[model samples]
Target: MREDTKYALITGASGDIGREIAIALAKQGFHLYLHYNRNEKAIALLQEELVLFGVDVIPIQADFTNSDAISRLQDSVFQLDVFVHAAGNSYYGLFQDMPDQEIANLWDIHVHFPMQLLQKWIPKLQRSDAGRIIFISSIWGEVGAAMEVAYSAVKGAQIAFCKALAQEIAASGTTVNVVSPGMVDTKMNHLFDEEEKTALLTDIPMHRFAKPSEVGEVVAFLASDRASYMTGQTMRLDGGWFMR
Candidate 1:
């Protein structure tokens, strides 16, 4: 990677949203460091696709559940122009029945590791002309759900983390923001039954789940020069599913 080519690191690059973000940023002339825990094949294919944009596609992997897993990533991120945290999971179960490990792992994935990596990227991000930090949060973070209590909790934490960190680093010219997307059409929502899916569809004013491409567009904008003034904002792409 050259010093002049702008760099963007996207976690969970094999995922629906992360993959779209990779493409979106690539289109914006960002050399990408695509991070994935598994699914090397998917990432390889995505890397192939992104190379058509004529930007560098560097695929890296790390287990988000482990604290020291992402330490090696420090060596790869030479210049981080944009940092996008899109790696996360959703737990669908009774809140009381949730195991302690489930909550801990969820928090580690959605909150801890992201903050850790962001801290490491702060210096490099500050050096870039366009420094942007974007987190792909959930609409459930805004409006709690009956079955997704733990998911909502960590997501709420992510939102709060973005707000606080935005202020802490505002003087550095780095813009931090969270993109809270509603029921996005992804494998993460495969657990829902036909009836439950129908019920969820009715709640969205648009009568449709959000597309990953739609969320990617917002993220790309925040990373672009036009959105330099935006920070600490939780922009929703939920189709009025959980309007504030």
Candidate 2:
């Protein structure tokens, strides 16, 4: 690693949106710490592709559902400039039908574990000249989704956390923000059938779901020095759907 190489730790780097974020950062010459729970093959493939960008790509695995894994993840990272929280799962069911264990799993994966990891990594971020903390939240976090109540709650929590943390660390030159994308065209949205997707399109003025690369580009900008002055703000990438 070069002395001036910037390191970015992206959780869920094997997933669709996460993979794009990793690629965007790599294109900007960032050494990547790609974190994944399972899908070793996906991470391996992504690692192979990222190396062409001439940046070091290190893969780290940790099940976020298990809090004890946080320590291991922290130990794996040496230096950090950006931390992107993109690891999450969405539950599609009525809030009442959701199981206690599933709710706990969502909370642990989306909020609790990430918070603990940040607690450990914040110091390293502060040491850097410009540090960025970004959360890949959802449009549902801004406008509640009926069946995804729990998912919306956790994402909303992420937004609140970002705003508060940005305030706490702004003096240190670290910026925290949320990228709440609406109806991203990823495998995650495959749960919606054709009819459902069509209906969703009608709501979005752009009449289309956002591409993963679009999300990645916005994230890349946030992680860059250009976004240094922008913190505690939510970048709504929802194509005019549920605009606030």
Candidate 3:
């Protein structure tokens, strides 16, 4: 790797939103560490696509549910110029009916694993002149959702974590921010059919879902020198759903 080259590790890079964010960062001239849990095929294809941009792309597998994965991740990457935590799943069910294991998994994947990565990579990021940490948070983190109680809790934890960490690391020249998207058209919404989607659309002022590329572009910007002064902010990518 070239000494002048920059590295970005994006968790959940095989997913729709995370894939777009990886591509966008590749376009920004970043060598990428694409992290995916079990989707080797998807990560392979994404790695090929990212390589087209003339930047180094490496695919890594680590299940966030396992504590061992965090150790493996820490051993895999030495220095990180950018870190984007896009790894998480949505829980869509009644809170009372949810199992303890499900809630634990939600907190593990959404909070604990991310905290471990941030803690591990923060020092490496501090060494870079343009370090960036971005979390793909959700509108549920702010106003939250009805059936997504556990999901909302974890996402809310992520936002709070980013806010506090950003303040703590500001003088290190690293910027931390959250891109809390509203209703994005990703696999996470697969549970909702056209009818359900239509009903959900009624709540959004834009009457539509945001494209993955839209969120990706904002992430790219945040990772760039352009967003240097911006940190500790939750930039809602929601189409006026939870405007504050």
Candidate 4:
């Protein structure tokens, strides 16, 4: 890694949104630590794509839900200019049928892991001339979802966490914010059939699902110096889904 080159450590980098964010960051000459729990092949392919930019790209695997893994991550990455916590899991079921373990997993990934990473990297990130911490939340986190009760709870807490942490780190030159997306066209929502997709799309004022690359570009700008004054903000990338 070049001594002067800055780095962004993005969790869930194997997913569609994560992969696009990696490309966007690479285009801006940011070295990347693309973290994934599984999908070795996808990470390998992403590495091949990223190499075209001639930046340092390190693909790492760590289950963010595990406390031990979180500790190891803190040890490995001492400094990060951009920290994007995109690692998340979702369970779509009624609150009555939701098992205890599934509920725990939601909080582990969405709430605990993000705050843990932010806490661990506080000193290092503050040392940077400019640093940004972004949490990938969902519109469900904003208004709360019916079947996605656990997911919405955890994600909602993350939004609150971002606001509080943003204030704490403001004087230290670090920004903390959340990006709440709605109905992104990713594998996560592949389980939805054409009819279900159509129903969901109709609710969005834009009448379409968000492309992964669009979210990526938004993240890149938020992480850049151009957004220096933005902090503690829940920037809604939803296409007016919550409007209706």
> lDDT of candidate 3 vs native?
0.91
Ranking of models by lDDT? 2, 3, 1, 4
TM-scores for all candidates: the values are 0.97, 0.98, 0.97, 0.97
Worst 10 contiguous positions by lDDT, candidate 2? 235-244
Ten-residue region with minimum lDDT total, candidate 4? 235-244
Residue-level lDDT tens digits of model 1 in 131-217: 999999988888878989999999999999999999999999999999999899999998898898899899889999999999899
Model 2, global lDDT: 0.93
- Best-matching candidate per lDDT: 2
- The total number of steric clashes, by the backbone 3 Å criterion, in model 3 comes to 0
For model 2, give the RMSD to the true fold: 0.9
In candidate 3, position 136 carries an lDDT of: 94
Q: How close is candidate 1 to the true structure, as a TM-score?
A: 0.97
**Which runs in model 4 stand beyond 4 Å of their true positions?**
1-3
Model 1 alpha-carbon miss at residue 165, Å: 0.7
Clashing pairs in 3: none
Supply the global lDDT for candidate 1: 0.90
Which residues of candidate 1, in runs, are more than 4 Å off?
Answer: 1-3
Q: What is the Cα root-mean-square deviation between model 1 and the actual structure? A: 1.1
